[model samples]
Target chain A: MKKILLALSLVMIGIAYHNNVKAQSEEELVQICTMVAGDAEYLKDFRIKLDAGDPPPVQRFPVVLKKDVKYRFSVCNSKDYEGKVILQLFDNNRQLATTYIVATGKDYPYIDWVCTKTGAYHLVYSFRDGKAGLAVGLLSMVGTM
Target chain B: MIKHRVILYQALIIVLLSQVLSSCSFCSRQDVDLSQELIVPDSVIQNSTPQVSKAITDQMMQNISSPVETAALIKGLKIPFNKNFLASTKQADWFNTNFEKAFALGLYGCDLGYLNMYEKTSFVVDYISVIKRLADDIQVGQFFDFSTLKRLATNNENLDSLILISQQSFNRIDTYLSETNRSMLSAVIVTGVWVEGAYLSSRVAQISNHPKIRETIGEQKVILNFLLALLKVYDNDPSMAKLITDFEPIKKLYDQVHITYELGEPEMIEENGVVTFKQTDKQVIEMDDELYNKLITNIQELRSNLLKL
Candidate 1:
């Protein structure tokens, strides 16, 4: 009976180890980014300089929006891990507009704002513990009533 | 002895049934003769550069003038496309038709069919090169130097040779359609039409705002329109009608994604001889996993049905 119990314990340990490895791999695939806009229709293009340790960033094209149109921006991880990302928005003079903390992999976390002003803005998105990378793309602005 | 005889009879019956079921060679003497007659000219044979045949050009013009006859010809031409798809159990008929039509329309090589002769020849290499080059050119970073329109007008011998090689390679793909594979073919045709149509349509939308890009966008529209029309026909098929109904929601999603490609979304402002307008990231996310999986399932079912046929 003792020998059988020992074998069962080993099997359980092996399963746990396998699951842990899988969870780690999943955690590595998470990606996060922040989008900022001066107006609802256009997202300002900002430069992203990845640290040497960061994974190669994937490029995205711009999403177009009309003036006064509500837009939402979110960050997502490709892996199974549920983590949090921070989004910081800045005006042309580098003044803070909004700061948001988004939970990744659930509830498409993004900013919903209508453009009252039309111009360029900068958005900075940072991830926790170097777990995710940032993606930048284009968006257009249109005049809306 | 009686039992042994019965067993032998059963075996014979099974063999006969298998033979009858397996035989799929439907090519008639006419088909063979037509294929044989499709001979390339010496110039075309020596150099892969497609030499436009005046005879074919005239014939094509005449056929185009007669809309009814042209439609009939297109319908008839679709037979080999269908047969090959059914036989090979590969939904490659749509691709083959595009290549064949392009070639027949003086876009590829000299038209052999104008002489009332069909050539059992292959232009796989040329077709592949043309497709690859076109795809590359349209890629985001100018991966290929020549655009689709430019490739159509390419007069270089080396490029022509490459195209010819590609066309030849395409011939190796068996396109014989069987009853079992029909469903599979239907699924593939649907998927191909959906993807290609969406791609070209979005590109058209992207260029719609630019006067300079209008011509390129128009050409893309033509291709997209053709793909959509083809999809409509397949959707009308009674046996595979369910697939089309199922695709309606996905098609709507595709349209939503394409809306992001609208041309007027960007404008140019000139200030002190410098022109700059607001540029935002435009990206369309792919269909969700559930939808994608459903589509894959439908395609697999179609494939399985075709295999049975």
Candidate 2:
């Protein structure tokens, strides 16, 4: 009972203190993403909460990517999170592209990849350097062209 | 793939052993060593609940892409909504075992996704009721919020909202199940959704000329292996054991599929606040027509078996 109460309290605080937490709980993400998904199609979505100093968790989703389809990977993070949360795209063997850039100092809301392959690919997600926050990653096909 | 196969082989050997032990009612046996490679990670989603559920669920949610997207692909393929293909709602009452309930919950989840995608608002109640019945049986009905979902479904404009809320409701159930140590049920729900989604695509691909559907079906080779590995962790349980054993033939068909990737340069582009990449990497699927037809037929059989119980 005490642990349950403590966990609830922590989540509440996590929401109140971190504007970076766009989603208070998974429920909030649903309501927000409903509006966010728009006319655009929905694909796979992942909700994650990160803590400081923890190696950004690598959650891998194995999906088939066909040649000629334009695939989009986007993130909806708490706006208060100052640091960029990065989403990387990797084919079975090689690292393809990431949602954020370091030297150019630009972080993208999403990564749009026109797949030339029709096999499985992995969409990996993480945050910068032990950054603490909650984010939802969305995969969609914006177009075929 | 060799390493994965080796891991699966070792895992299944333990599953066979566990099956033997359970058959002898070895629950009280002190000699039975319980240490096995658990797919559930030690920590997921900031460590709030039982680690077992989160680990398995994280692994699960990753592998099964939302069927809504598959519905979209079917739509993009210009395939019409064929209600005749969905598992019958009347059968929801037939499921007496937790195994059946979990699988039915999943079957209907895909049905709901398919319905929502086609904007077939009137038919939503059939699935929502069956899912509610299953969810209630599993003691997670509180998370479903039936009234709110009904309201969302009644309005045509809220179709998008309905899908989002449905996703949210399921996630809430995942959280609740993980916290309450009822994640085995969660595993079944995930599996049911995967099976239905796979079956739905196969059914549509049969008549549709979409190449994506064919490749997507072929890609299940890896996902199935991953799902079987996780399900085998609970092979000691009778229902889980049966599911694991029953799913082997599908895995055999998948074994014949050869998926290879030709590496290419990945390009990045940024325009008007949208950042996108063009993946030059291409995946080639090698499977003859005979194998593809056989695989689809097997998927249909599996789905049919699921609905029967």
Candidate 3:
């Protein structure tokens, strides 16, 4: 009976510690996002943590972009992780904007998009050089056109 | 006697383990069997189960627009705040069912967004109190840091934090609901927010014919289509069925409205080393005044029906 109780207590403690760590990491990520949000009205935020062992090439999230509204997509990488993120806004026809400039080999922290079409637009987040990473993405409405 | 005591302790441990294990996946065999029986053919019952398409649910979850933006846009027009357009806070306790509570929570969230944007700090506490009650009723109250939100709402200087924190609270609740397979509740909340938002915008448009308000009203046609598709995914639920029925008239009215985009030369400007790609494209929303009036009328009726529901 003592052995069983000990095992259960260990499991409970492990679970609690795991949850606390996760909550702290997420809170830190959200704080980074809030700092980057600037004067834009907060709409939605995306929290991305990729497996370090085998990270995917890209993670895609769909957002319904309204016509004639200026939107800002901001990204910040967790300092604990080595990976820097590249955020892209695109649809079926063309890539509207991206944070990393391929030719310049540079990355901006955010992408400002004045959406013309009211449809499902994709926000693709990927680590620079396809490295594993943790990042947070924020979507804010700058204004209506 | 010690042996008997040990046996009792072992039995209690077994019961506790079973409860814990049962709470995890693979324990709900009855539910799994029932679902399988409904879909699987007799010959392949042991081998196959139908896969649910996550596309509709995904789109539905993604399409939940922030009412704060709508409220902000309304504020941009310099319109006076009308308390009449808001859902009654007195009806907070009146919602007994999970469906009604979740829906009313959405309504109050929208109203709170409006109140926050308009800087009505004094009236904000009432909405926040009712919001807490409804949120608690639905068992998602943990996501809301009520004390922090209350403090922010009480201070006019903290409007920005109030809006961000409130939106974050809703976002957290939504994420929780989705993760826990309680997406039906999340969908209802989205529906509530959308309806309340549309009602507020249209009501303002009726009083003052602002072009931006009209355009916002017209944009709802696109959002309405997405909302309808989302709601249709759960049409099996009676509450959802009624919601769909209530919204159909508004949808029909919106169908007559036209939104066409004229692509312009995209302009890329860099300010302080920050690049902004401004699409010179213009979206022309062509809706006759008659159809706009009809849409507004139907939306009002839908809101009325929802409040009673």
Candidate 4:
């Protein structure tokens, strides 16, 4: 009877540990994009893009220009692995304006500053398996107006 | 020994009977019987051919030819002047020309709607030919026909003529639509009006320098009247009421545009033909998902009420 009880306790501990690990991985996948509204006068044609890579699916969301407008972009993952992601936006001059370090399971890994001029903008994002050094997904320029 | 053997036999029989009954229950688990209905005989099935009715064929033909019968089709369509000209004179010419096209298109759309509903193939074909001829004339800067315009002008005076014709057409086709079709029609009407209004508004913004922009302010007024009429019609129809409410965001956007830009009269052009105007940044409107969802839910409830009607 004692041995049976010991085995049951071990099983319960194993289950709990497994659940904790799963919860942690899920939390990491919930990372979202964030935005900060800068000076109102300088911003024009504010837009958001969601890029999920290579058959190249893109989603564009219009930016509403209110003083307190904030947004977050996120990629959801369904696995327990190191997620390395880069979120980038380029100005009309093809120069990078904002960049963010996005990791798997981190909240709001991507954020952008409000653009203050009327010109073309581009967004690009890449996600890689940190352990394998292989690209898992790439989403670029998800929105344009 | 006989009694013991008899009791054992009874027990064995009971156990077997129960097992058999349980297996039978499992076999008959499905609620419906599969073999109750007679299957088609192979000989009859081999000889059967699909029949097409004359009435259905006639209806299909009518459906195909109605659009061609109404409205003037334009030839060598030049892109309508964009409203971006800085000179008022240029803008006025552009707007006047575009307005004519828009009017023609609107009338054409109305005719198409009527013909589609009434299934009047010959009449539709004849009207479409006339429209095409008119379009050709307009392209060449020649007068095609103003008879339709004259008819419209005198329509109120001679209400019995066109009104009776329209009523007859509506009555013939109105009853044929299913509930789903009616719902779809409501959506189409709402979307159409919204798109047309947006298109007109954008054109107005482009022709901001045109003198006739002020003159054509009446078009916006007409749209508002049309919207009110539509709203009243939809108020009585719950399904349509829901769709109208979905368009509330667009209404608000229009209101903002009207207030911020459209309220003022056209700026007077200076002697040098240059109109001095300052460009200002307009804030972009954002749609809130939560609000839209609530609106949609309300519309669904409205639709349910309409369905009862």
> RMSD of each candidate?
26.2, 13.5, 7.6, 27.7
Higher-scoring candidate on lDDT, 1 or 2: 2
DockQ of each: 0.01, 0.23, 0.31, 0.01
Report the lDDT tens digits of candidate 1 across residue range A8-85. Answer: 456556655765764444333221222233222222222222222354222211111222233344444433333334
Model 1 DockQ, alpha carbons vs. true complex: 0.01
**Candidate 3: DockQ?**
0.31
Better of 2 and 4 by TM-score: 2
- Tens-digit per-residue lDDT, A23-89, candidate 4: 4543333221111211111111112122334533322111111111122233333443344444444
Q: Chain A structural similarity (TM-score) per candidate?
A: 0.38, 0.70, 0.85, 0.32
The best candidate by DockQ is: 3
- Among these predictions, the greatest lDDT belongs to 3
Cα lDDT of model 1 overall?
0.30
The whole-model lDDT of each prediction reads 0.30, 0.68, 0.75, 0.30
lDDT of 1 at A128: 46
Is candidate 3 or 4 superior in DockQ?
A: 3
Query: Which 10 consecutive positions of candidate 3 chain A have the poorest summed lDDT?
Result: A49-58
Candidate 1 residue-wise lDDT, B1-309, digit = tens: 667656655655665455444432221211222212223222221112233332222111211111111112222333222212111212223334332222112221111111111222243334334434423332211322224323433433333223222222211111211122322342232243233323222233332443322222222222222223333444555533654454454344333222122112333234453223333323222344454344334433433343233
TM per candidate: 0.21, 0.74, 0.84, 0.22
